[model samples]
Structure formats: structure tokens, C-alpha cells
Target: MAIDERSVHGGAALVLRLLVCVVAARAVSAVADGPLLNGNFEDPPNQSQMSGSVVTGEHAVSYWKTSGHIEFICSGQKQGDMVLTVPDGSHALRLGSGASIQQQISLTKGLYYSLTFSASRTCSQNEMLNVTAAPVSGSPAQTGELPTQTVYTSSGWDSYSWAFRAEAGLMSITVTHNCGEEEDPACGPIVDAFAIKTLSQPEASQNNMLRNGDFEEGPYIPPDSQWGVLVPPVDEDDVSPLPGWNIMAYKKSVKYIDSAHFAVPRGARAVELVSGVETALLQEVYTTVEGSWYRLEFSAGDADGCASSYDDGSSSGMKVKAYAGTAETTVDVDFRDAGGSKRGKIEFRATASPTRVVFVSLGYHTKSDNSGTLCGPVVDDVSLVPIPQPYARRLLL
Candidate 1:
């Protein structure tokens, strides 16, 4: 068959598209580093860091749970690009002139590269850490600098993001003192790590059903229990009181799911039904890998109830809904009094195994009655222990 000119061009274009696809796939795989950081340390904690010019604002230690911490240890440290991590009394971390950071991969030409990182300090102070993209080795034409600084206050964990473009190859990402004229020779802001990870081009249509953590709407792990992480409640941030227990309510009574460590992907299995008072339910979602064996253990307390009122302000009981990612899925757990057990047990079950979960939230049901706060199904403990994949043939209830 004789091919027409247009047909020939179309064929060529198709081939080009295929070639581009292959290249893109390869790049994705090369950069697709993940479960990200697992087991390097706490919840995978944070990477390594060094004591640069320490801030006298407060004595906080740089914890290194994992290795390869891209830390700015000292002032005038000529390791990567320029000197960084000098302290400004007013702010906690800032840049010194010529400060930069080297990365593993090369950036595109004239394409703006964005940077984002999470930082936290022991205390809440006026201190700020300046974030900047310093050019390490690249053409000046394409090295459009970004003007923004990341600050780590004496407060909680906060994030800062900025963008910059570069010539082909690599460039140094730096954090330095924002003020150019005045320099604090003795001050260097300690950088936890510099991130070069790029955001997805298009919003990823991820089945990310559940990756890890208790971000869902169930398996609430109460802190005051034995097996509970008690670090904080689900969706609770660092601002939450540390080293304490977060109560999971099921009965209007309070203190449900006490001392529970809701395994990643952990879900509620049962609810205690009572006749006297309103009840509460606690659930948690923990992260886990497929076939990983984990344990969820908890002991419910003597059931209790409370006053309930309707939208009219009448007293009664409320309804409940559970969610993960708040992304809304068919994923919701309902509390049932079907079981004859008075004290409900919140822990592991045999079926409905989850590989990954963001978080588990237990929301109460609001009906015409929204009076007394029901809290119970006391979860004494919870835990998730990863076992070999395929999980045990049967969940050991």
C-alpha cells in the first residue's frame, strides 16, 4: 500500500510519542524513591543534622534518627557550595553569603524548580530560618534566584516552600541569613535537610487507598492505655500535649480505647451496646505493608451514657461517621451493639486487612439529639506489629 504524506507524518508523530513515553517512564522510576523513608528511625523521624552556629534563643538538640542527614553543621562550612547555617539573633536560622547546597540529580534549563521542607523547633520563638535557592555551579542566565526563607521558630513544625529555575546540571540549594549588610559571624542556622523532590506534574490519580499512619476514621488509640501510643490523638499535631493519652470516645462516658496503639491501617472491629447511657467509640488507622503482621489490643471500660439533645437543643444521642483522608470513600465503620459483650474490645481482627491507611477518625453521629458527650468503649491499648507479608493465614483475634 502506498502511504500518503500526511499518513507518513502521522506515523512519525506516533513513534515520537512512544519514544517520549518510554523516556518519561524511565525518569519516573529513577526518581520514584519511596515508601520514602521507612524504619530509618522513628515514624522514620528525620534525617541527620549537624550543630551549626547554635542559637542561644533556646537549647534544642538536633536529633538524627536516620543517616544522610543534609545538615548545615557549622558557619563558613565550605562543604557543598557556600557557607550557610549562621544564626541571626532575631531569627533562628539564616544564610551566610554564598551559601549553597549540592543535590544528587540535575535540574532542567530555565525550568523553575520548587523547594519545600518541614521544620520544627523545641520552643516557640520569633526566630526564623531563611530559605533560599543558591546556585552551586550553573549558568547565571538560567539561575533565576528565589527570595524566601524557611524559619524554625521555638514553636511547632511548620513548612516553607519556594521556587527557582536553573541551567542544565546541578545547583546548590541553600539557607542563609536574609539580611545582606549585617552578618552574625557566630550565628549559623542549623538546617535539618534540603529537599529537591518535585511535585507531580498532574495531580496524581492515586489509588493510595492507604499508605500509612492513623489518618482514617477508626481504630482510635487512646493514650492513657497500656498498648496505646498515646503520643497524640488521630489528626493531632505536635501542638497537642506530648507524652499524653488522647481519649477515644464511644460512650457518652469518655475514656474509650484507652492505652491503645492503633496499628497502622487499624480499624474498629466492635462496639459495646448498653441501655443506660449514651456510648462512645474509638478507632485508629495505622500504616502497614501487605502481609505484615500487627497486633491491635485494647480493653473497653464499663459502658456509660450521657445527655443528648436535638437540633432544637433537646438532649439525646448523636450519630457517627468514620473517614480516612477525608477524601470520602465507601470506607466507614459503624458502631453496633449486636454483641452481647458489655465491655467492647478494640483491637485486631481476622478480616478486612489493610496495607496502607492515612488516618482513622471516629466522628459521632448527630441527630435531633446532641446533648451529652458520650465517650467510652474505653480502648485500653492498641498496637500494629508488621509480620511477614501474606499476613497470618488468619487474624488472631
Candidate 2:
């Protein structure tokens, strides 16, 4: 059969058009999955939109809507005797009492997203930030409060993270200052950076029963941050910022440290129980076989970032207590040790379908430089594997 020249040329043109459409779709998806617009608050407002440092217009800040009293702060601006700090960029936003800033974000429905932002207390010791995510399609909102009373880093700034599941294609994120009526109207937290990351739900394999055991999959950490992100305690595991793990302590949080700032025994990240027994990390593995023998292996060590000496000379060591179902063990780490970390193991029998694993610090520790910053043992490289009955009998014999 003879092919017509016009038909052949037309077919080739159609194929080229299809490829262009596919490429365009991928580009749009990439932008949607990336960072938020003007998240670092580096985009300044015009002179008409500002009255001094306070924002006078509602939509003054680019890509955001403001309500009530909102101030645009510079990096080294002084407020009374204290100097304001903006670590993420040259500018930040200060939400006064009853003030809030919100932006509409594009997201994939039903997927979990972790929001990381750099915040610090600027005024009162009880300053707190209330963050909320509400769907545009009339779905329920997810809200959480971040307390900035405790300064984890010497820089007077710390990164905080929270997670929420998207319920619609478009969601609105709002950050408000939670202060009482009698307090000063200028008292609030300074917010410098905002970042969002989609979390991939991890699954267990034969080698490791716990998902995200290595602490590799979690919230986003700023590139310039030396102090680790703080994962606040959540009532439910489904909304946990740290994937597959729940902070089980009331009004406490675990410091998610990175290898760039602290010594990690394994992987690029780990968790530090900074609040002694007040902070607990808990995870439930659903793959556990009932009444089966299993071995729990983990690494517990000091980050070696603490102070060299305390007034009582008793804060030179760290200890972590681990619990697997009903069986438990304690691992002690001396700060003078060379590696700054050590490996530990525990063997236990599964009591139920979902086995509970928990880690908590036994004592309080502070930095050696007299900063009085809270520091504790680092937990990493956790794994749980089933042990054969025959092998268990031989070991016991």
C-alpha cells in the first residue's frame, strides 16, 4: 500500500502535540509540590501598604492575606532592650495579639503534609503560635499550638514542625498569635520561614518491623539551621509530624537532630529526648506476630554536644530507657566515651498484634557552655525482627 505524504506529516504533528501536553502537565505538578510562595517573608511590601513597620493594608504582604495588627520586621531591628532576630532571611512577620496571616495553597487531597517554620518568642515568656489548615470545600480544619517559651538554641530561634492531611484540592493555612486580652498588643512570636513537605507513608519489611525506623523520613529541616527541629507532642499518631512515631508526653516535645549539628549513631537524623522523662517517643508496629519471639535493636548515645561540667558534677552522662511490649531495658552512655554513641539490644516476645515500642530519657542534661539548654541522649537505627523458635531455644540452652 502507498502512504500519502499529507497523512504521514499530519500524524507526526499530532504525536508532537501530545508530548508537549504531557510535559506541561508535569511542570504544573512540580510547582504544586514545591515550597510555598513568599514563605520566608523576604518579599517586602510597598510603601503605600505599610505605616512604619506595621502593615496597614490587608493584602500588603505578597501572596498572603493579613488581619489585625501585623508588623514587617527587619533582621537587626531593635525593640526596647532586646534585638529582634530573623534567621531564615532578612525579613520576617510579627503577628500581634489577635493578628493572623493566611495564604491559599494547592495540595493533593488525602495526602499528609508537614509544615516546618522558624519561630522565636519576641516578648512574653508564654508566647505561643496557633496554626490552622482549613479546606476550601468546607471540610473540618486541623489546628495546633506551638509554645515558644523554651529556647532550644543559643541563637534564640528554633524550627518547629506540624503535620496535617489535606481534605481538598485547595487549603488555607493560617498562623495566629494566641495571647490573652490583658497582655501587651505587641507580644507574640517572630516567624521567619515556612516550608511544606509531602510525607510518604512507610511500610515494614522482613528486615525491620517498624516503619521509618531509621528516622530518615520526617519533617523538613532548614539548610542553615544548627539546632534540630522540634516535633511537638500530638494526641494521635495519624497527625504526627514525625512519620510513624507519636510524641506521647504531655506538653513536651522531642528535638529532631541532624548529623550536621549533632552526632548521630546511624542515618542522617535522630531524636533527642530533651525533656528527660517528660518526652517519650512511641511507635506501634502492626506486623508483629502474636506470642512470637523478636529482637529489638537500637542505638542510644550522647550527642556529645552538652556542657563538659555541671555544678554538681553529675550531669556528665545520659541514659535512655526502651520498652518493647512488656519487656524493657536501660542503656547508659557516658559523655567521655570516644564514639559519643553506643549500640544496644533487647529480646522480647510479642504480646499483641500491634507491638508498642517506646523510648524515654532517664535524667536531665544541659549544655556544657553554661547556656542551660536542654540536651539528652540520641536515639537512632531502631529495628525489630522476629526470631525463630528453634534459634531462640538454642540460645537459651
Task: Rate residue 165 of model 1 by lDDT.
Answer: 49
Off by over 4 Å in 1: 1-105, 110-112, 120-155, 179-184, 200-397
- At residue 318, give the lDDT of candidate 1: 25
* lDDT by residue for model 1 (58-140), tens: 11222111112123243344434643332211122333333322223345555444443433322223234443343445444
Model 2 lDDT vs. the true structure? Answer: 0.83
* Highest TM-score against the true fold, candidate: 2
lDDT per prediction?
Answer: 0.30, 0.83
Query: Per-residue error at 167 for model 2, in Å?
Result: 1.4
lDDT of 2 at 170: 80
Q: Where is the poorest 10-residue window by lDDT in model 1?
A: 33-42
**Error at 46, model 2, angstroms:** 1.0
With candidate 2 superimposed using the best TM-score fit, by how many Å does residue 204's alpha carbon deviate from the native? 0.8
